[model samples]
Target: MTLKPLADRVVVKMVESEETTKSGIVLPGSAKEKPQMAEVIAVGPGTVVDGKEVKMEVKVGDKVIISKYAGTEVKFDGQEYTILKQSDILAIVE
Candidate 1:
């Protein structure tokens, strides 16, 4: 199943954090924190500002690093997706 964001919303697939510690010690499954970095899966066309449509800054396939505590988490059809405003994006990864 495919999902699309609406308005100024964006969808990101979170990238998994480190599986092992710096000492090369493998961490347990339950020890991982949700990564803040993710790849942009889809994006809304644009947002309306002052009755004018503004183009989105990021595009599909752009890797982004977001804030640790940002956006709303949503699940659809057993798949997880993050719904964040375009302004919530911290930076675009090269």
Candidate 2:
């Protein structure tokens, strides 16, 4: 199934975090921090939200950094995803 966000919402899939540190120490899954980076899966059209004009700056396939603890988690067809408002996205990775 495909996801289509509406009104400045965004759908993203988390990118896997590295298993080892730069020092070559392998970290277990329980020790890994939650990944804050994700790839844009879908974007909503620009819309007026909270009495302000909100525009979507990211598009599908864009890599983005989001605020920690932001967005709602979802599971679809054995895959996980996050749905958040465009404002919750911190930056678009170049």
Candidate 3:
């Protein structure tokens, strides 16, 4: 199964968090923070939302930074994904 976003929403998969710090110190799983970076899995067509035209600026396979607490989490086939509005995306990583 696949996730298809509607309106100006987007579906993203979280990038794995690093287990080691810059100093090469291995941190425990309990010390890891939620990853803010993600890879775009699916994109929604640009649509008018809240009386304003929302255009999709990102596409599938693009890496992006999103608000830390944004999006709804869903689990499918034992994999987790986030579904959120395009506006929730902060920037597209080049």
Q: Write the per-residue lDDT of candidate 1 for residues 1-94, one digit (tens) a residue.
A: 7778888889997877657678899976457776878889899878898998877999989989988768888888887878898888999989
Q: How many backbone clashes does candidate 2 have?
A: 0
Q: In terms of lDDT, which candidate is stronger, 1 or 2?
A: 2
Write down the TM-score for model 2. Answer: 0.84
Write one digit per residue (lDDT tens) for candidate 3, span 1-94.
Answer: 7777999999999987657779999886557888899999999988996798988999999999999989999997899999999999999999
> How close is every model to the real structure, measured as TM-score?
0.76, 0.84, 0.84
Residue 3, candidate 1: C-alpha displacement in angstroms: 1.8
**Looking at candidate 2, what is the lDDT of residue 43?**
91
Which residue segments of model 1 deviate by more than 4 Å?
19-32, 50-53
Error of 3 at 2 (Å): 1.8
User: Per TM-score, what order, best first?
Assistant: 3, 2, 1
Q: Taking the candidates one at a time, how many backbone clashes does each contain?
A: 0, 0, 0
- Would you list the rank order by lDDT, best first? 3, 2, 1
